[model samples]
Target: MAKAFASQGDTSEKNISFTEIGAGIWAFTAEGDPNSGVIIGDDSVMIIEAQATPRLANKVIEKVREITDKPISHVALTHYHAVRVLGASAFGADQILMSDSARAMVVERGQEDWDSEFQRFPRLFEGHESIPGLTWPTTTFSRSMTVYLGQRRVELMHLGRAHTAGDIVIQVPDQNVMFTGDIVEYHSACYCGDGHFRDWGQTLDAIRAFEVDAIAPGRGDALIGPEMVNKAIESTRDFVRSTYQPAAKVAAKGGSLKDAWNEVRAVCDPKFSDFAIYEHCLPFNVARAYDEARGIDTPRIWTAQRDLAMWEALQN
Candidate 1:
């Protein structure tokens, strides 16, 4: 039998957890669905990473209400993926912020990403009709942008290119807690379809420099202590290396995509087979890695047609 396309078969709803990882900070995480972070400023609220749609984002809002009634003043996008940004309208945020590169991505391939991702993971796009078209950033910053609610400060820093050219991390310097959007997923597969493997490693190193007591990663449970935080970082780095290296080696040797996929699977499955979205991400991850290995610096846009063609060619 041919494999299902990406996460199409994952229809079961995951249990959502709204965890208070720091004094006024929280992580809204579902089993492995896209995660969002809440920073409760002294008088207002700031959300990091919106859910896939308005309806889904409402759920996060509900959780936020349970704690405080501060209106959501800002929404910070870690990158320019449809699942992460299309839900901006739900927040009704005063301003939507993203890195300059992320804004460029939204301009370049926003439509293609929306179409392809919607087709690939229907479950994630449950409230498809509710999405108010493409999410746009009202504010764009180059390297870092800092927002303060009262005396509480949250810094959005584009440490470097990793998951995407515009990946950003939200840091609560006072609390030593960071919300790493897709930059570091704990016990979850890093979706590398639009990633930079080589630069991703360097980004991880830069993230490690911060004295983080806790980290709310892109997926999985929140890391509460330094030990767990380091483990998640290391796990993410290991997965990035394991996936990219094997594929790059095969591609450099003039091997086919199938050959590269098989090579990576052999090494990754043993260690990461149980990780969330491991199977769903393998094909696209390998495809990008293969391209990068062959000197393709920019990742090609993934249209619905390309998604199916790649899956058909490497159906396991």
Candidate 2:
């Protein structure tokens, strides 16, 4: 291969930041790596989007400890992606929550995703050995579920599919701060290998309708006011559209996947080449965009072998 596969070459650690986006809402971000959210409620704390490993999750726990001693009673996983859910055990939360569709995806492709991501980004899985196994949710809701962390009312809703079919967002009504898991990103590239390009904008619209005051996005910096929040949402929308439009046009004209890839690059690179994880996510994003444009509704499960094979094909 001409280049390292995915983020395998990115071995350097990133500076971590634990920023408070709202009164009790915190965003634990590591440069452009996956982000985790902490919502300290009246009596307990709720975590959103566990990191890739127990070692990483401990980093978030350390920051949470700096603020309050409230026991973390619940963990809400927005989706079933290995990078986001595998580190859940570190929280020791009594209740692990997820959308019903997310749990189903875990049953279908959880192990495969773990293997695939572990190979793709070795740096993120710093302590893979410590991970017991796939993280399973103790409870799941079909559409929307409300959880009360003492007096704090947290709403988990499936706005629509964007980053993945089972993506859900956590909203704090009192604070008007939403924790959007991969559904919304600031400056980071959206990993769309398992995404729904068509429904992504609609999902963003749903989140926008709320006019939330703050947002703890899946990656990049925590968006603090209405202006920054709107900017991130629109930029994310542009990224998704720019990626899919060129590829969709190529597919419409019966072009090969390689052709679609070049077309997508032609459109996306100039605008988003500087975004975090741009190169790492490009090949997978292009492949999925091509598939979706060709009428494939569901994303194909990505195994370790498939990841390499796809990367090699794109390289050639």
Candidate 3:
């Protein structure tokens, strides 16, 4: 079960669960909550993603301690989202790894994003001051990097651009499990503020090409079996299409952004009524999808003021 809380105010769920996806992989997920994954090896451990702050990371560390006594050796950041990468120091890993693009995003807007996200989501950053600094990747790879935790081999690869320019997936070949950052959310809404919709579908295809039986997405429930695995993929696809087509039609027809949002809200709200963070994601998704459909090359960086402006414009 996933326990959820939507920031500090409004609605939230509790009792999040960490499901063991494979022999050494465990996923801590809450409905509408940010996710963190742990991979324990024979003598050491590698955490897939870190929570937003040390306060939250401690809770995850406590969970991992209950399962293994091995020290956390590496922290692999899937992308550079503040909620996902800001708390790198909490794990106290030997190394933190990420793709080149993620590092670039961090350098470009790390401070802005930190301020922006903290304002948007307060509960996730319970102890904001504990953060050491911007979570820069100690080790960075252009496309792929492979690490051997003792004898276990874990391959980290950047499939393509979908969620963000630097998105990566953690693949455990032996375990047949892939920890997909925000590329393949299961039962969780795609926060497409900086996403590539058409390209995102192709990225999902790239992920499916891998022979994965289990997966831990950026948020929401873990995909335990093959059936749920397929369901998550298909559901993500549906969510993408449902979010895009409406926006595309409006954009292509010269309709306003507000019109596109209305179209997306009308179509998606009913289908994804139960998805996590559906409301929070709607405004951002519509904004990006509308831009992509109109041929905007890169997503406009989301700022604190812009987020409020967009929310106020669409939510009413």
RMSD of each: 1.0, 0.8, 3.5
Best by lDDT: 2
Quote the positional error of residue 203 for candidate 2 in Å.
0.4
Worst 10 residues of 3 by lDDT: 1-10
Per-residue CA lDDT of model 1 for 43-69, tens digit only, reads 899999988899889999999999999
Number of backbone collisions per candidate? 0, 0, 3
In model 3, where do residues sit more than 4 Å from their true spots?
A: 1-8, 11-13
lDDT of 1: 0.93
Clash-forming residue pairs, model 2: none
* Candidates, ranked, lDDT: 2, 1, 3
lDDT of each: 0.93, 0.94, 0.87
lDDT of 3 by residue, 1-316 (tens): 2122243364344567989999989999877588889998878999988889888788889899999999999999999999998788988898999999999998888888888788777777778999988998899999899999989999999999988988999999989999999988887899998888888888888888885889998878899888888889889999999999999999999999899988998999889978877766777889999999999968788888887777677645
Q: What TM-score, over all chains together, does every model reach?
A: 0.98, 0.99, 0.95
- Candidate 2 lands at a TM-score of 0.99
